[model samples]
Target: MKNWLRTTLVTLFGFSLLSGLLAGCSRDHHADWSADDVAKVRDRIAGKMDLDAAQTQKLDALIAQLQVLRSDIKGTSNDPRAGFATLITGDTFDRNGAQKLLDEKTSALQQDGPQVITALADFYDSLNPDQQRKLRQKLERHKSWFGH
Candidate 1:
């Protein structure tokens, strides 16, 4: 039971991380994404999931919250190694600095991760059995695409 719970949490975390990365990749480096941008992404995900009206609304709210969290993280990030230039310029390694960055990231995750996970799990649980099966199959197909 504990293993299953851990696996579930990890999978959900990976999904959230992948979604954030993909969203970031779609935008210009310095461009601030508007609410419409977030809405479009939420719409695309809802379409893929075949969510109903209520589900779509719930998803939209959840995505909005997550976008806020992402923005907060980006806005407060102070890592000197954030840019590629620092890596190529032979910058001195600062172990304490790295640890501080890691601590900040972990703190952010701890603060917001449970809310994201709970929203996801609630939405997933609300799916019909057939929809759940379809989702499982879709996940399996995606896994196979990466030779997992």
Candidate 2:
């Protein structure tokens, strides 16, 4: 009985350690979009596309530009729950407050939109025909997820 109990405890402890290690290995958290996260994305896409150095460099530039734009847009955002609560704190829906939030978001988009477009265009144009086709296919496969 003593030996059996010891064996069971050992097995359970080993499994628990393995499960913890495996859980830690998965680094694909989607919440925070930091520079490191964007670089990982660039690395993954670059691998998938088999990008040459020049194309990879363009991709890097595009990814960098996107990170900057994301930071800029995110800077304009506050806690959504708090913002919405403020809007509804009064008896009436604060249309003006809501409009102000919308305008801020829109302004951020307008400010960063052109630079993003340019970077995207430069990266896409740098791709050869085969790479472009692969990119289009990948986008098509994922487009439905975006409600397109």
Candidate 3:
């Protein structure tokens, strides 16, 4: 009886945790967006990267392409499993589905990976070595000041 009770409690706890996580990632948290949405994200990224008007326009274009690629890879929230889990999950509990989804998300993340890296490289390259060092110090100081 004790063992059965313990197992039942564990199952209930796991179910509750899964439900909470799923609820957290529902429609309100989805990243579905149009080209205009990418423009806004691009604008925010531009501000973060200290980009000028021309650079912002270019970044917006790149973001639009990345958004399309991302959508294809991530799929709709309804089937948020990279387009294959729904099939596999029909027969089993789909424990492997989580790992598969994570792998796909990681792979999809690489879609815009190089461009973002190149953009950051270009920004740093444009700055003098002294400025780079100063920027690092400023960031560290800010982090320290915030008790982070």
Candidate 4:
């Protein structure tokens, strides 16, 4: 009985550790994007691109539009991991429920993603060829920073 108890306790401890690690891994670090965060992003991009007054204004407008769309989408979105805890805790596996959650996320993306892409495309088209080259080079350098 003592050996059985010890084995059960060890198994429980292992399960607890696994669940904790899974929960931590599932967290979204960039889930919340506030206006202040958007401003910081704009400033960083502007600094890298050396945007003039007109480009700065356009970029600022694009950032504002994106922030508004993000807010709208976030307001209507559910917790992405709502049912994940149950799965981690050894509850009945609901594959359909998990698929539904993914579908909801995809639908949300489809709703707002097109507008963002269009805005970014417009901004990119507005850049001069030299500015475009500089931006491309800067992006390539960032790939190296990520160990790519």
Candidate 5:
């Protein structure tokens, strides 16, 4: 019994130490993206597309537009579950209330969608045939959620 307890205790300690080390290695995803990180990603994308000066400018504009849209969407909701809770509180499902909640959420998207679309269009139109082909190839290579 003493030998068994000693081995169990040693194994538990080993696991705890290993878990701590692994947690230290893991990234803090909650941290916001820094400007340098954004720039590096932009530069990498620009390099991949072989963007000219004007094309690079357009890409930057698109990135800015996307960031704005992201901010707008993120700012719209503090707790998504809170909105749904109201709709389900009554005995019957409140269709009107649900619709209102959806509309409220979608309002931000509706407002910002046009700008995102325009920026995307401008960027795509700026790309030459080779660059467009490369972009399409890269997109096609991306795995879907179903792993196609």
Candidate 6:
């Protein structure tokens, strides 16, 4: 009986350690972009660009690709916000938790920003010079409201 208890304890301990390690590994690879959010952004971009059917389809695909990549990145990245969603259901706010979440977000943004920039470049490069200029203006005007 004692041996069985010891074995069960050891198994539980092993599972706990394994879970923690997997959690950390996951933080390094996730990106959080929901489908609805992706569709909305694509619609906005398409509208601003006055994209033709071909351009719209291409843009939609790009947005979908980016969204999926973002979700993957969020999964692998460590951001305090990972736990923030639960805060809404809980009774109190944990300032330390909030700070950690913010820190994670800042770190994630720093690490993943270049990838987003590269993707933007790909999209921009596909546009004609006139369209590019217009796109730039639109982006500049909305920059404040974006990335929030």
Candidate number with greatest lDDT: 5
TM-score of model 3 relative to the true fold? 0.51
Task: Return the TM-score for each candidate structure.
Answer: 0.61, 0.70, 0.51, 0.62, 0.65, 0.44
Superpose all Cα atoms of candidate 2 onto the true structure and report the RMSD in Å to 1 decimal. 14.6
**Residue 84 CA error for candidate 5 (Å)?**
4.9
**Considering lDDT, which of the candidate structures 1 and 4 is the better prediction for this target?**
4
lDDT of 4: 0.73
Candidate 2 per-residue lDDT, tens place, 47-114, comes to 99999999999888887777677666556444434554577689887999989866876888899889
Per-residue alpha-carbon lDDT of candidate 6 for residues 1-148, written as tens digits (9 for 90 to 100): 6999999999889957965765655453324546776678778878877776767766765665566455544555356345755544557656777687668657767676766667666676678788889977877888973523
Name model 1 segments beyond 4 Å from true.
Answer: 1-32, 78-92, 144-148
lDDT tens digits by residue: candidate 4, 19-128: 68756755656577666887788889888888888888878767766765665545553564555655545556567766875676577678888877877777888888
Q: What Cα-based lDDT does every candidate model obtain?
A: 0.68, 0.76, 0.62, 0.73, 0.79, 0.66
The full ranking of all candidates by TM-score, starting with the best, is: 2, 5, 4, 1, 3, 6
User: What is the TM-score of candidate 6?
Assistant: 0.44
lDDT of 1 by residue, 90-143 (tens): 566455665765677677777887887877777788778877898889888788
Cα displacement (angstroms), candidate 6, residue 18, comes to 29
Number of colliding residue pairs in each model: 0, 0, 0, 0, 0, 20
**Model 1 root mean square deviation, Cα atoms:** 12.0
Shift of residue 91 alpha carbon in model 1, Å? 7.0
TM-score of candidate 1 relative to the true fold: 0.61
Q: What is the lDDT for 143 in model 4?
A: 82
Task: Please tell me which predicted candidate would have the highest TM-score against the true structure.
Answer: 2
Q: For candidate 4, what is the total of clashing residue pairs? A: 0
RMSD (CA, angstroms), candidate 5: 12.1
